[model samples]
Target: MCMPMTGARRSTSFLLALTTAAGASLLTGCGVLPGITGGSREPLTVMTWAPDGTQATNMPGMPATAVAFSRWVNDNGGIDGHRLKVLTCNEQNTNIGAGNCARRAVKEGAVAVVGSYSQFGSAFMPPLEAAGIPFIGGYGISGEEFTSTDSYPVNGGQAALLAGNGRQLARDCERVALVRPDTIDGDDLPPLINSGLTEGSRHEVADIRAADDAGDYSSVAAQALERAGAGPGVPARIGRSAARQQARKGCVTAVLGERTETFLDSFRRVETADQKVRISSVVGSVGQALIDSTGGKEGPFEGAYVTGWYPESGDPRWDAMRRVVDKYAFGDNRIDTDDAGVQTTWIAYTVLKQAVESLDKDSVSTRELAGRLDHGQPVTTGGLTPALRWDFASMLASADFPRVVNRSVTYQVVRQGRLVAQRKGFVNVGPTLENARTSG
Candidate 1:
């Protein structure tokens, strides 16, 4: 018979049992159990989060695209025969909500968080970093997206687009009016646009601030048009001839996020036929979806100049993505092929898949996945971006955004209700951003 344990022995045994149970519980909470889940042949879990049904901004398509991508990949034998499991969360466009989503990703043991949209990067990135999870292809709304170590953004984000737009418009417009939100984020826009204009030997833009959630923008539009020197009473059929009349034409570029459509609605109502102001915006603020929702050919965006991070939706490079949507996401109205958010999600998953394939392993953890990416391997997005490598050499010299690897933007024009390439190649804005950083 075993002798009865004494006081110290019994306490030590009880403490050991308590610690063991706690360790198991912790692993379970993190969604990592060797044989039970995340096994060699089990599914690889990831997450995508975006704001939905919000008062200010919404990006339901990001998560919707992630779900569709999981289905498409699973049908195709998944990433090296391992099914991809995607968890989605609605950030609700708030700081607390963004934090909650990041926490959920950690608790659910997401290997990576891919192709999500949120302005509250400050709230979300810390949790993701603490959990050692990589953040891939975040819609570049917040400054934190560029600064965070874990973030791997696919596009040059708004920085490249605004600077590129300034370069494009500088070639034509005599005066440029910049209409942006009256927030902290808006403070950075003027300098960026100015950097490009300064590079092009053009005058700086007339800065106009507007409320982000304002229902009426007629006054703001009127102010922008006036500042742009878009005097009323020009003929409606100005045509390309307006391009030649450089002295009379001024460009109005709006960087407001979702409220851009509302602002345009008010702008059209106040804008006269004579005003030859060329309306301009980045892709996220104005795209094919908005053009279709507003009248197509007769929409406010017609003849507008737009800047984007990728090739047009009809580009042959997107053939594979289109095929996936056609086969897997049929009748899924939420997944718009042209929406930049949806496109970003596709490209992000492509990066994730490549990383997983490179691993060539049966089981993967968040640490291992992030390690592979941080090792400086370049990811090719089939011409969507230059082979993306986040090594020190790939990073820009900008003091504010050292991790901006892709500095290319495409210039597009709205014609016949479609966004077509105005210039048939990518324009590198790395130099402009560098200039801005040094000057700032």
Candidate 2:
């Protein structure tokens, strides 16, 4: 005597998947360069990623921020009387591009490098380390890069974020599924995934490669649903599958997606092809392009749950950040495009700035910077809660293996195909890291 499953039921299951999976991410914007009123001959340079060359053209905000940051340092009598010279590179999808950018930063005598962008963060690391330059920003928290003394990661470690996500899921859902890239930027999640689950929570995983060449989520969805006891199309099953699929794929579902719209197109086909299988995800799953391209039309992604990181700045934080962005960066109209990126970048810059200013001249060396970071300082940019600290060494202090704490966890849902904040509070689970290994 089970009731019929509907899209609503499916949606819930999908959200459970996203929230239950590992990791947290906060987007931040570019930092402003200081305006030096009068300065010494020495110039301090900062480098960042301008992949689309939009900083030069479309998004003038990024460069403006860089300029303002430089100008601020100069106006503040310059960093120890050294004028700042900011350099930005459009490191499009090529390592060579990133390498070139890094080389430029090094050649220009950059005391510290910031904002190299994603995987490029590591790409720039070796050079900065070799040059004995202190690097502070550029997101993505890979464990390998975290080991470097020359680099200070403002962003939380990926291992901790994922482990936190897993722990949260273990508490929230009986059956949880993981859908993520096969080649993650940092640490592999197999161990983190294992650590997050409780004794009896069911687990399923989908290894989506970088190219996303495969146009299917059915096998993954089917596997997860089967394990979740949703294979029979009962009311619970329908909801479970829908929710699980949505969580893992976002709006893409089990369908393939060459582009965001392609996901919607394929999603419709999948659902139409089979009405019983529900597919859902967090709101941000469906790309903004799809949302706009479809002119806000309802599609498979209409009611997915989007769980992502956000600062605790409240509404006022966003406003203050916006002013910082608008005043400093140019053509930042798309600030709304990726709020998390903006916030993260800002946080990273502010942390580095504070750290740099706070350093006693003797502690300017790379080793000193790394040492000082151990005290676990709290950072609050734009009033975001969840104070971040550095403890990778301690987290890895175990005799046999590394142990980590899932410091904080948060959740957001996709309403009207947009990612919106849900209840955001960290669960203080003693989540620990297990089985660490270098990826081949």
Candidate 3:
């Protein structure tokens, strides 16, 4: 027969069992107990860098848009239940600053850099490649953005825009004069424009180079007008008659960043009634904001032809982006609803969200994120861009820009102080870009 234990001994045994059960619960909460549930989710980290308050090409809206997007996402349950941590850097429009921003992103463990603007791609891309971080939705100012294996550009950069502009002008103008910055970066503009003009069976443009930051462009403007052989100024009715007499109407296309406005200012002052010169430009070099600031319908850009990567800012497709700016931006002046840099940032984050959701695990690293994008995932941007895919099969065949997947641009014109679509659809410049690569 077994004897019963004392009451004090029974109490001590019961207390020991309770303590062991509590220890197991604590371990599971801390992720020490694996195989039952996945580890605790880690927040996703991203970096966005742009130049603000710089003497040349300031893109303050890019980083500002990135911050606003993070807030909007976090407020609405974040991407796949993982909190987004956006670290912003001001590149200060210097090569050194761009490299430093890349180094910081690597040191802080950012999986990707999205929707940023930096002309110093050569300086920054190396650091990101070394860390295996994907660069997505960049401003596409640098040729490296199109060439880097690590870069997933959302748009076709300047190459496509310039080529498309050439095609647009070819239909209307007999002679085209391209006024571009005289810099190492601007060297690539002529060949790309020539390719498009050639495809349209038009003669090559008269390529004129000017200082990017010149205080005045009177001489350059006068020279471009003279080369185009514009006639003397006359009344509107008389000008139309004079234009018909001329064998070819002249078109002047300016691609100087920021200084395009100043160039136009000088151009208008020297313009004669008989000149009948039509001004044309790419979208980044001219926009609604510039038109409004310069004088709307009366502005020098009136009747200008422009090529852009997306639909007009007033289109209904941008309604979703405008709502985010309305709510989370809280009237922040830097975040303009129509700014291209801001639009680019919004699209970049959309890509990031889609990429993160495709992951099997809640927690991801730089390598895993980049690998997912490289594996031929198609990301849709609600009609903001063609479905973006970075696989080799989806990329353009150009040897110089093997990574460029979007070769589409829209033709637009300034009318009644608003940018309206001249054509209802996108113009394909892939053939022109391919020809450029092979001809060289």
Candidate No. with top lDDT: 1
Number of clashing pairs per prediction, in order: 2, 56, 5
After aligning candidate 3 to the native by TM-score, how far in Å is the CA of 130 from where it should be? 0.3
**Model 1, range 34-102, lDDT digits (tens) per residue?**
333232355799999999887677888889888889988776667865789999999998899999999
Poorest 10 consecutive residues of model 2 by lDDT?
A: 23-32
Window of ten residues with lowest summed lDDT in model 3:
31-40
Question: How many backbone overlaps does candidate 3 show?
Answer: 5
Stretches of candidate 3 off by over 4 Å are 1-39, 236-248, 437-440
Task: TM-score for candidate 1, please give it.
Answer: 0.87
Q: Name the regions of candidate 1 deviating beyond 4 angstroms.
A: 1-39, 236-248, 437-440
The local distance difference test score of each candidate is 0.83, 0.46, 0.83
Candidate 1, residue 435: the lDDT equals: 81
Q: Best to worst by TM-score, what's the order?
A: 3, 1, 2
